[model samples]
Target: MDVMQRMERLVEQLNQYNYHYYTLDQPLISDKEYDALYDQLTALETEAGMALPDSPTNRVGGELLKGFKPHRHLSSLWSLDKAQNEEHLLNWNNRALKLIADYNSKNPDSPLPAPTYVVELKFDGLTLNLTYSDGQLVQAATRGNGTVGEGILAQVKTIKSVPLSIPYRDGTIEVQGEGIMNLSVLAKYNETAVEPLKNARNAAAGALRNLNPRTTAERKLSAFFYNVGYSDGISFADHREMMEFLKDNRFKVNPYVTYFDSFDGVMQELHSISDNRSSLDYLIDGAVIKITDMRTREVLGYTDKFPRWAVAFKFEAEETTTVLESVSWNVGRTGKITPLAKVEAVELAGVTVQNCTLNNAGDIERKNLKFALGSRVFIRRSNDVIPEILGKVTDEQDGEEIIVPEHCPACGFPLEQRGAHLFCNNRLECKPQIVARITHFASRDAMDIETFSEKTAEQLYDEVNVHEPSDLYTLTYEDLIKLERFGEKKANNLLDAIEQSKGRDLASFLFALGIPNTGKSTTKVLAEHFRDLTAVMSATEEELTVLPDIGGIVAESIVSFFADPFMQASIQKMLSLGVEAKAPEKSSAPVTDSFFSGKTVVLTGTLHRLSRDEATERLEALGAKVTGSVSKKTDLVIAGEKAGSKLAKARELGIPVMENEEEWIKLLDGEQN
Candidate 1:
């Protein structure tokens, strides 16, 4: 076949495989076969220098957008009215019955019967609207403000469960659904995530809003179509029929839906759902009870913000009352002191809860949680493994006050207070701090030293006299073999791992240094900008601050770290031991000036296309000074996914903002306003 014909055939076959595997829950082709075809198609598209709009390659993501464009929804996606208690639900039912009775009285000859309700699980996730034209998936948006939403077609296309094209052709059809990350998916993601998501709802929301479709694809999100927002040349007699049609057209419909003629039957299903919620794969905050008949729904209509035809019966928070036995202070890897509340053992969310995180000293003060011994307190557990103290339940104030430690609990070093956090300043001598530093150095994101554990660090610290990061390089296999459970083979393996880590990239080495206020991203910026260790060591605070995302605080911290005699000695020792800190090669592209010329730019959040280091290099090449924090001095801010405090602060300071990769590229090419 010719290239165009071959490409067309591959698209059809790949999409068919996707449908069978994702929508039908069956695979007609082996993964290897599918991948081979996909690779061929991608190669053909690249060679042609053009790609079909609906090509399966788009699922891997194409060009990063500057920002999401506003899409006015064809039909308003109204929220469901809520009810908390059984009494409130009954009251709502009574109102609905009364409305039906009034309708019957108005039309005496054609009397309306009591409305049968369709009950479905109210999935705790981000609401999405998918529009299909001529059986092809076209537009997908978030339910931003009911009338208007942000277009997220590319991200939505990544969801395999959502059909790229449906069987029905002609006219636009809008399907409203909940975009959710199953609990299993969330658990799997958390196993590798640096920061575990609080809950599945947040995880789903974050994934859907992510700038990169590849990220959304990696998240393995699912969608359940619950309602039809708009449909042309088709109609359903009831909600159940509509859901059936959606399922037939390759859209996922909620499996746990039932029809009820009375409120009592609906209540029974709600009770059953509540009892089995823990066993479910997805998070459901509540149960939605809606009038089943389409004609009945029209008669009920909607309020300003909510539909009168449906009511969400919200479930009570998962909380239990427990006694606060005592409080314990624990030191973390960063030497930050955290308060752990030793609560009386109680069962919460299918787990036995004894200790709860009090966060920090500020949290205790803000919550006014009098850590009075034997005081009754309410504890709540969300999707996180750790439980948190909600509030005190009793008025028993006759107990000892919890005190913040002035010294480190482990090393007895004086604790230094910075903002709301307290840290141990003894980085060199403190045993726990030293071990944490070593563990962090060997962590996956840093040096990626395999088989290095906290236990290993502790053993090395006590037995091998490994006080500093550089000391690890000096250890002989004989030194490790002396430790318990350390055979000759194990010792050699560990020594080999350590040797391998010595050749890690400069960014990794910089992060392994554990410089205060310098994270992985910041370390990348430093490595890319400074080029070499010596340059970084000799850099002034002013010079450091001029780099992207290196604010005054980080600049000062880097300067102080290099200036410290102990740190300087450690770096020199590592260098002498043949630790190679290779700098990133400079880009070959010539420098150009547009808006970024001599501008003070700050970047925040996760970028879709460029790493923080690459973005910094691009800005710097254009004579831009990339700073960390937002201030009046900041000329521009490049905001990306989850751009939080810095983005807000930039707006407060009236700084111009570029929200995505496309805008940054356009500005660099002198093509943007």
Candidate 2:
């Protein structure tokens, strides 16, 4: 088919699949087949020398914005200080332990028990700022210098990782999210770039700051929404549950993220992630451990830049002593040449350590590094994660210069030498890039086709000529039977899935498009709020920022997604194939005053008459704002059995305190009778 006809056909196919997988939560095609078609379109667009206004490739990366616009935060966005070293971390842990111990000791009559800590990955990326108006996405910015930040709503939209809308029943709310790059994608991008990145964190940071948003669109930056800044209607008793609620709202939260039951468990989890960091697809600089209960956090209170209830354990690089047998060069997706060190097999963290990587030639020259086929080197891992040779030279040894590759190892392409690095010019045809891109297209956050394994995708890319997501529709049972062990039933089932997936919603389709910065939750929010795929594809800056979770960055991504020809064609093709893309209904309520409407209510002690959920629900239903613990800002404190600090604080603050459930009920009922 000619370029236009090819484009027309591709758009019809992609649109249908987009509706099925995203809207219906069901898919028909294998990831491999979809990827092949997507790749073909991308290739065709590149060759046509024409740009479509709406294309998936356009949302990949973004431009570095000018200086921040100095937007004030509704609540001060605070930065957490790293627990300087192991000793400091231990001290902080002990302090928390002692605080609980002392509290129990002082209140012998009815002591409070210590609760467990929740630990999570401290992602290395830009802190995204989002504002919501009546539970809709409205504004987004970056944490520029903490207090003031630039508006990046347009730029942020390009990132598929961030949500375009929030899931809350409130008038206004602000949230904080983190933008990050995964190791797998980073590895792939670096393999294709002229200068391969040293790490995912650096790459993510760089991608967020690109001068041209169009350039930024190529990096595939991802992010996770974590915090609620301001709230009007919704209430969360526990911090962990709040996260769960965010997930329920279709926000793409971190799955590896977990909460703990105790201090020991939290510490163990921290250590475990550190040990297994190399295996993780994303880069983490430290562990963010917090009190799972919101009340506990409120009771603990805040320091200058951090909450006293939370702490971060930043791990140092992991170093191992090993004998280096030999060194060899390898080509990456971006064509950058890297050196690999063959190490003697040694057991480390359950797995036998066989090979460690050396970043570039500069690293070799820095340590006066040499590979005499047998040399000793200390291998250092990132965040105690990935194994890499830091340097070498045992006391009694002669030195030798490290041998570097003169050509690409994978394709025999001529290597271009640069400062401290070498690169290959084989861009699209590169094996690593092809495999990685195809795999990425078929990933769960993308088309979401079930039972499509990476191994199967690899076979399609290598054995079959499949290169994009839409290509799956072109395949037949005959195509599958040709492969080893391919049966009629399996092939038909795969085709059925691909066919059914044509009706996915817009966000999933956008996510499946693999737009940079766009991740799971962002897609969901966009899909829900925009109503139709075309609206998002054609959304302006003002329009995107009007949504809850969508920020400058995410807005930009949406704009870019629609700006690209390939992505647009994909949408059209899916639509032609009878794909239906529509958003879920939004809940709306009138602003009528209820009992708790204007009252600031604080609960203290334990209530026998009502559970926390019941109490909060009634208060919220009545329009009352229930805050955690008791403070000077408290309007009224409802005291139950054995009220402690909150009661004392209420009295000290001269705030009115309700003695029992009867008194609280009386106030709610507005009855002296």
Which runs in model 2 stand beyond 4 Å of their true positions? 1-67, 84-87, 97-113, 318-673
RMSD to native, candidate 1 = 20.8
- Model 1 / residue 568 / CA error / Å: 53
lDDT score, candidate 2, position 207: 67
Clashes of 2: 118
TM-score of model 1 relative to the true fold? 0.51
Identify the leading candidate in terms of TM-score.
Answer: 1
Q: What's the lDDT for all of these models?
A: 0.82, 0.67
lDDT of 1 by residue, 1-673 (tens): 8888888888888888887777655578899999999999999998888767667887767666678899999999998788988898998888888988999889988776668988888888999999999988889999999999999998898898888878888699899999999878976785556444555776789888888777788889988888888988788889888987887787877556778888789998787666655446787778899889887788878777787788999876556788888888887767888889998898876678899988777666555565566777777676455887755664456656787899999889999998768888887778888898889988888888899999999989998888878889998977988899999999999999999988988999989989988998899888888789999889998898788778999999999888999888998898889889888877655444456777899998768887887788777877788787666678999988656446645764567998867867777667223
Which candidate achieves the best lDDT against the true structure? Answer: 1
Q: Each model's RMSD to truth, in Å?
A: 20.8, 22.1
